[model samples]
Target: MTATVRPGLADEDLARLRARVTGPVLDPSTPTYDEVRRVWNGAVDKHPAVIVRCAEAPDVVEAIRFARRTGLPVAVRGGGHSIPGFSAIDGGLLIDLQPMKTIDVDPDQRLVTVGAGVVWAELDRATQEHGLAVTGGEVSDTGIAGLTLGGGFGWLKRTCGLACDNLLAAEVVTADGRVVGASDTENPDLLWALRGGGGNFGIVTRFTYRLHPVGPILYGGALVHPAQRTADALRFLREHASRVPDETSLMAALVVAPPAPEFPAALHGHPVVVLGAAYHGGLAEGEHALGFLREFAPPAVDLLGPIPYVALQQMVDAFTPRGLHYYVKSEWLADLPDGVVDALVDHHLARTSPLHQILLHQMGGAVSRVAPEKTAFTYRDAAFVVTVAGCWQPGDARGPHVEWARSAWRACLPGSAGGAYINHLDADEGANRIRAAYGAATYDRLIAVKAVWDPDNVFCGNHNIPPGHSGTRQR
Candidate 1:
């Protein structure tokens, strides 16, 4: 099992690797290789030399060992939805975790344990059955691994804290192909690193989360207005965000209405500003906390109502379906001033791409309450996290869409807190942006963790935090 890592692949070594793993090992020649390699991002078209559909941590350990022996770059795919396409690799080894879909819920303990491959929807469905949930990605299809590892946000974020915040423990296969458990009682520093440190130190095979009571239904919905009202909506969100209860999540978006039967045909293919709100507290308080959206000049479309928490999490699924060509840039802004609002309206909102949109997630409450140094997810206390996402079909020209997204992101950067969300970073944003995601101290600490668990950086495919020697191990 221990082969000296070299920078070339050997057929005999590959054969030995295949013989050691329990999962299905696939090469490019395999009939289903193409299908197996496909990821959720249409923009990604990587073809890893070997694809290991890991069924468990042992399978992962073998794959990592083989890849390290061959010195082949490695990529890990959980839900297969890395916006920056880190879930795949070109001519390397792909550790596809999708086959590890084991999930268990302990209702009495208020906890849920899942394999890395589990997506938000699958986990949400299981947890909802037990009347417990955690803060997950807004789009249900997003993989739990990538989201939680990079500071997950969603409707529950403001009230219940981030997905990383709920993390209790994890079982990961370190770079050296050793199985390790990370929790307060064991390898606690690794647990802290896994909370929001990206996939730097190791590959997580299983996760344990502390769940909160989230019943079947919640008060939440969206209010849509004309695109011309972008500024008005932005201003309203800016003012309204500060006073909203910790149990409430108020967010906004500027997007083109999809031509679905549920929406007015006349409004289809056009831009609009959407104000979406959710409350996990009392119904009466929820009404009072979110009624401001309706009073802002009767919306063109009002879909606000009492809806199931699971259903509410899926409201964004339509616009963010699998395989959509997407490019994203984000910023953490303390407040949405007039200049920022104008920048969005004049530069981004004026243009319309069917699925492209600007999203503003109002942040505070439980998320900000956690000290910046509590976890590797140091980007905190920002009034809002704004994202400019350009989405289009695969056949369309990617240039214009990418450029448009970049332009909008740049316009908002000047008003930002000089940092980006680790999860939202585009591949091209480079190291500086990654550093900005976690300020100096936090980033340094993360690097130290990486040094301990993954000294040679075998898992460098994600928003990587390379192993370092300067800082002492936090444990």
Candidate 2:
């Protein structure tokens, strides 16, 4: 049905929109309007005029067409976890994809097909049933849409590849209200652009990925150490990471230990450096490889052991839930030098809030083998990707949390390769950062593709590139 031309969308248009989707339509007058509008990042406060919980691809198409015809801004939400709350917009139309989550696995071919709204946990559970897995977001609750769109980096990243790398194909709804499939063969150029191009090209409805034998069990978990040993731990981590097999992955976070029964009461609520290890091989080999990390001079807490991969992914999600203010900055480092370690240690010790954390994921292995130009993801050879995240209870504390995150980011900027990951970047970091994420040449190609698929910039809420007169679509 075509959109109604009446001001504020005549009641008839609302009825027509509701008729097209199986999910609920929430407006300002709806009882659950406020709840429906909330996103993962509490800091981003927006009030979209209408929220359409799309139940299928046709529902998405109808929402996009209606929003365009009405000349209203459209924001697409999958997991509601975009750092800047790009998933939702104020006084606009929100295309909520949460209700469309569905996962199907072809065990014989080792391929997994999932809807845009599927979260890491949902996909992980389904794939594991077939003794197969794919690279996914680190946290279980993270939406596959935002993560894959921005080129996912995770525990399996070094061993396999970014989530985008394993992507075999996708069904996307373009800005002009057309449905198309993108893969290495069909619409190849659009597929290339979608790899690490953010959500600028179109609204992805489903993704097909090549799966691997990951696990019901991976040998790894968090091993916490005292705050004073931060420097020593950091040095050891860097050296040990270089020697580990590609199948083994590790991540380190400097933060306060949560007050839980699993931890010693004395260490609870205190600053500590935690190491998360994941080894995708024999238990004996994993234990042997983890010996160096396990012998870290009487750790404050030692939770590292053999556990289900799905459980590990869900571990950190409990701490970083929705309705919390968050500010983040990320960088890819070629090497973690001594000076950089010192800076990280100093900042951690000086942190005024316990909510602050510095995340380091050792990158390489299968991820770097892919040619730079082969896909849209360009940061192929970096040694590590460090993310500085400040999550706090919203309200008066927001200022201090943001300030701490910003200061830490500024201090570490020089230590980086001069760019930020498009996924973790805060909304405040503007166009220059986006340009840096995709260098000059790549950015130019992305702009050219933007011209063909979305010349009018209907998908401007993401890290955007305006279309030009270039008739040839680049990338």
Scored by lDDT, the top model is 1
Off by over 4 Å in 2: 1-7, 469-475
What is residue 258's positional error in candidate 1, in angstroms? 0.9
Candidate 2 root-mean-square deviation in Å: 2.8
Query: Per-residue alpha-carbon lDDT of model 2 for 222-274, expressed as tens digits?
Result: 88888889888888889988898998898889988888887788888888888
Task: Write down the lDDT that model 2 would get.
Answer: 0.84
Question: lDDT per model, in order?
Answer: 0.86, 0.84
lDDT of 1: 0.86
lDDT of 1 by residue, 1-475 (tens): 3222233667788788778888888887778889998888889998888889999999999998888777788999999888899989998899999988999999999988999999999999999998889999989989999999999999999878999999999999998999999998999999999989988888999999999998578889899888889898889888888987898898999888888776688888888889999998666677777787788988888888788999999998888888889899999987787888998987655563667889999998999898766678886789899999988888999898888888888888766876988889989987777878887888888887888888777888887776784333322
Count steric clashes of candidate 2: 0
